[model samples]
Target: MRKRFVMLTSASAGALMLALAAPAMAAPEADTIVTFDVTAGSLDITAPAGPVDLGDGAPGSTITNQLGVVAVSDTRGGATSVWDATVYSTAFTNGALTIPVGAVSYWSGDSLPGSETGGGTFTPGQPTTDDQVPLTGTAITAIPAFSHSGGTGGSTASWNPTLVVRVPITAQLGTYTGTVTHQVA
Candidate 1:
């Protein structure tokens, strides 16, 4: 009985040592964090859809056509405030024959970026002036054509203005080319 007891105690001690020496079976877990930031909304202006063709007409003739401009904003939450857009004719030239700025006229009566089929009128009061030419290159004369202001982000406005060109009797017979620019502030 003493021998048997001694053997049993020795086996129990060996089992305890093996349990203490072995590695833990459980795994520890931890968390990882992440973050970022976004920039404010923005405003954009697109070029006119067409070249605003006045077509072929005899000198002293008033050629009329429509010019369109589209403005947009990215502020979807309605944080955006007042927006003013102005339109101007840069210049028109037929090679050596230059058309004076005063010869071009802009009229407005459309609602918020009016269009031809949009049911807006071109009553010629927006700019309150018939002549659109600026005295100097840096001085841009605004056209009394478009009317668009104040909007939330993702808002869009269109300006379909009437462009009238008075062909000077002295205008040399040829094709004329020019550009119109839209500015937002």
Candidate 2:
């Protein structure tokens, strides 16, 4: 009985020693990196597609017309975006007959009904008829500098201008055509 007991104790002690000496099972893990990119935007402008026609008037009279809608779009997604719109005109001519560019006047009346949108400060070059400026061969500010202060994404502004042409008393009796150009920067 003693010998049997001694053998049983030896087997139990060997099993306990093996369990303690074995390596423990561990959880495995790995690391991964993540990434992405963002592209830049731009600023643009647009003008009326149709021609602006000032109705006919007798010699030594003035003809006036609306210059349609002109718009500026700033899509640069900038917090402090600024832009200016300039305008110039060529001499009105009918063959040899010419009407001087200085005789043309421009008035940036106001923004069209519900045409002004987004957030920014829009200032017309000519705020009123009294403030009309003479149109010369050289470009002048049609829409003065616009400053985007409290806005997000993009901003836009649009306005209708008035054109006044004074006919000289000695002007010829024919249709006079001139080109008016608008640019933004």
Candidate 3:
């Protein structure tokens, strides 16, 4: 009976030791992970529909323009934003994106008090000042503007504006490209 009792006690002790040592076993192995995201994109600004029919009256004549969505956002209420607009020329890959080639015969204010064909009415993509380009001067006459939303509930702000440019027919006779840039401060 004593021998059986000792055997039971030893077995019980062994079982207890194993139960306490189980947690000390090291985990199988470690793992590795990697991640990535996207930002910035190429923009395509089209001369909005109702493009001046090339043969209706005069191709690229009596010109001025207004491009909508002057700017865009990727995230909801993102602090940073992108602005865009299309011009008569599809590509202004000129050393810069905007060019100067003519004289501004007239200037128009923002408030449009008359009809679309009236004077003093702001043409979003035309010169706002009646500027003249000298034989040795720049030709970009008007500069447009960009309005960026601050946040979900904040007032928006205007970014770099477009330069009003004059393109006198007598200046050149071929398709010309222009470019201008705006850096946020």
Candidate 4:
């Protein structure tokens, strides 16, 4: 009887040891997830400084001046790849001595101050309406779009445009002023 009791107790202890040694079921693999989101970048432009102050000119004389256009990217995602510059002009008026928009022409050259290296090809603009025209000449009629190549730091570029106005000998003698508008995209 004593031997049987000892054997039973040993069997019970072995069973308890085996149960404790078995591996846990991995706790059902508790899982957690993470995520990230980003927003799109944007573009911006600065209009040329005004009162360009052409000073004075004689009849048939060509008055020359320059305006600078600057483009910038906020770089939210990356550098801007390309951009376009659009320009237009309102008729010049010295209290109604009207100077038609056709009298003006513009051309661009050299990366002006604050401009990046990837200078772009420029197409002249033409008179398209009483109030609007391209920046270059009548032939192109559209502002030339440029690449951000040439290492423009992926964010900013600038241009300088020389504007020419032929003052008709008939232009009534007085101070004249007009509005030139610029847009970028």
Each model's lDDT comes to 0.58, 0.76, 0.32, 0.60
Looking at candidate 1, what is the lDDT of residue 1? 94
Candidate 2: clashing pairs of residues? none
RMSD of 4: 7.9
- Work out the TM-score per prediction: 0.58, 0.71, 0.28, 0.58
Judged by whole-model lDDT over C-alpha atoms, candidate 4 comes out at 0.60
Regions of candidate 1 where Cα sits further than 4 Å from its true position: 1-39, 74-80, 112-140, 144-154
Cα misplacement distance, residue 16 of candidate 1 (Å): 31
**After superposition, candidate 2 runs with Cα above 4 Å error:** 1-39, 140-153
Clashing pairs in 1: 75-153, 113-158, 126-144, 127-144
> Which ranges in model 3 have alpha carbons more than 4 Å from their true place?
1-5, 13-44, 48-55, 58-79, 82-139, 143-185
Which candidate number would show the highest lDDT if scored against the true structure?
2
Error of 1 at 162 (Å): 1.1
Worst 10 residues of 1 by lDDT: 115-124
The model with the greater lDDT, 1 or 3, is 1
Q: For model 3, how does the per-residue alpha-carbon lDDT over 1-185 read when each residue is reduced to its tens digit? A: 99999999999999999999887778899888978764444322222243222121122344343322222222322243333222222222234432343321222223232322211112333334443112112223223322222232122221112223344333334444432222221
Model 2 poorest ten-residue lDDT run: 140-149
- Candidate 3 TM-score, true structure as reference: 0.28
